[model samples]
Target: MSDNYTKIVQQNLHKLYTKLPPDLERNLPGHRNGQEFMFNAFGEKCTITPRAITLGDANYPAIHGILISLYALNATPEICLLSPFKSFREFPDSMPYVGAFTTHTEQLLEPHVPDIRKSAALITRYFNGEDVPVQGGGDFAFTLFPLPKIALCYIFYEADEDFPASVKCLFSNNANRFLPIDGLADVGEYTSKKIVDLICDVNSPS
Candidate 1:
């Protein structure tokens, strides 16, 4: 990566990370006590774990950065980083792929998963009306480019207010609604076979 690219990624990551509140830094465990933070969860539960949050039980915060990091690891410059919210004035067509993802998330995917519909609606709104500029972060596009743009919403355990209680609720309620934090075995099983295959390859050794 160029010094400029690295610099930009570093700066933006810092900008975003600083926004994280105490919960992200919290050492608390889940009601299950067996559970861990969304990102920290491994094997099967990793994908299901809601994202980390900010305030009021908070919302998932680290998702975009990590996705961008994946994109940076795999994609090229022509493809932009897309989020639902865009500052397109500066980004132009080169905006990141996250926005395209938002559409997939709301229009096609969320409707199929009503259990999390309320949360999905809110996340959809967050990305709905914007043409924001892309702050080129990491070179994670390599991972993002191969797949169709898909929106990702991180809820964490924020659905509940009390700490471990909320987290337990989060896991219980959405146990079956796990997003592909890193692809689990059946992420896009039928919709796009080719893309799913590619993802599987990426997960496997080249």
Candidate 2:
């Protein structure tokens, strides 16, 4: 499986490099250092060149590698549209992944709302996030970019006497313009996991 993913990522990289976008820096919204493009991915430093994509000096996972390459290949000059965040169900052809998206992205964070709230500020900083006004009313909410072109708005509702803790994740209006539906779903999953990891880091004995 890993080998297959490697081939896929390599192929995508080749396609992206063949005719690199002239305005890659603006499209990717990342820094271009010579032939290398540097950006923050899932809160980690990601450097992509014609040959490979690395996150903090290590090879990025195949799935994520593909998403990054795709993001670059589809790079567009339009600014990221963050207002009017939309749910996964709002995207066309998103029905197939809606259940999994909810399970992996939202419900996955339900158990840690408190811990996540504790580290919300740190998570925002780690992901170059911006605090957004809570929409629809919630305990708190914030927007963060896991990729240069994609922004996710996360809203949290703490457990109350009648309802259990819950989480909601919404995407920037133009998120689909950057990656395909499946890729966007994976982004949600991975970003959610990264949040859980951050909470774990906070709890780990220092």
Candidate 3:
């Protein structure tokens, strides 16, 4: 299933790339040297060329597929402010992916509770390298531009005496312009997992 998804993503990327205007490509937020598109993904520098997409020095197939798909489909390079943290149901066409994010968050993030400090630390480190500013929301809050036009705000609320730690992922009001609700969900899941893995890596013994 994952391999199929990657193939589909790649096909869509190619189709979209062919239709994209040259003026739009020039204005894209990343470092575009000729036909290549470049940007920071997590802490790694990603370059998207006509033949292949690479993350740092290695070929990252899945990430390349998703990111390039998003870039090709992106409507504009203009960014908007972070919207209020809300459930997926609050956004039109986003209700379908709510269950996936909910399940992932409950099973992975909620169980950690007060240990949200680790998640917070990982986010700080990730964004710090990208030069993206992270501001306080609950326990930790930051706005990330996974693509130049796509902005996602992640807020982690620390556990209190009565409740467990909870996470809220919100997107810019204009998110639907770039990708569909399902694609947004994939982005959310991918981002959450990346942070979780980073935290685990930090805790692991070398």
Candidate 4:
């Protein structure tokens, strides 16, 4: 991201932190201890402190920005479990700009089947090890709880005789309770990119 974007995120965080009610702050979902909040970032536990957001011992700037923005918005973890999954376009009143990213989900994974499969395997193995449920959908699928209330589903379809491998990213219908469509797009893209990178590393020839 750009320096300006980073500054903007920091500013928004500080503004939202000040406006948050004590009761709401204390009860915010996922994990919490005083002003520090915790949640899973790409399968790893991370803590959001007043000074900085840390994934283990290291600081992840991108995750830090995303988490702070979510917290500042006071995102709730109450997912609409009864609602069926929906694509970004299906979201009510979704902005037109987001269609560019949402509509091209398949194209994004067309060239990365090997890495995508590897990534999905790793996710299944590690998450199952921790008892997180992984559901099957077109080859591979799983639900990710980036925030307590926000759930993102990633589905990967294997290449067939007539079609190339593809991926679809979906969100819970109630996701609007947390961030706007733009933020949701950011979260989805970021998570997708992270998964691809992890898979590439695992499949890299040594």
Per-residue lDDT of model 3, residues 1-206, tens digit only: 27776677667657756775576554455677877777765456767665556676654537547655566656575654455434556778766778886776434565554444645655655644222233445666666565556666766677789877777766767666666777777666676666666777767899
Which structure is stronger by TM-score: 3 or 4? 3
Going through the candidates in the order shown, the clash numbers are: 39, 0, 0, 2
Clashing pairs for model 2 are none
TM-score of 3: 0.79
lDDT tens digits by residue: candidate 4, 1-206: 45775666667667656765555444345466887777665456766555555564554546447554665465554444514767787876676746666644435656787666556657544323222233445776676655555667777677889987777767777776677776677667666665666677787898
What TM-score do all the candidates reach, one by one?
Answer: 0.21, 0.96, 0.79, 0.77
* Candidate 4 global lDDT: 0.61
lDDT of all predictions: 0.27, 0.90, 0.62, 0.61
lDDT tens digits, residue span 1-206, model 1: 34564555566445534442234313211122222233222101222112222111323224333433332223222322243322211222323533443343223332223233233333233223112222343111111111223222232222225433110000112212222323211122212232223334444665
* TM-score of model 1 (CA atoms): 0.21
Candidate number of the best lDDT? 2
Over 114-143, each residue of candidate 2 has an lDDT whose tens digit, in order, gives 999999999999888988999898999999
* Regions more than 4 Å wrong, model 3: 1-3, 59-64, 84-86, 105-107, 113-115, 119-122, 128-137
- RMSD after Cα superposition, model 4: 3.6
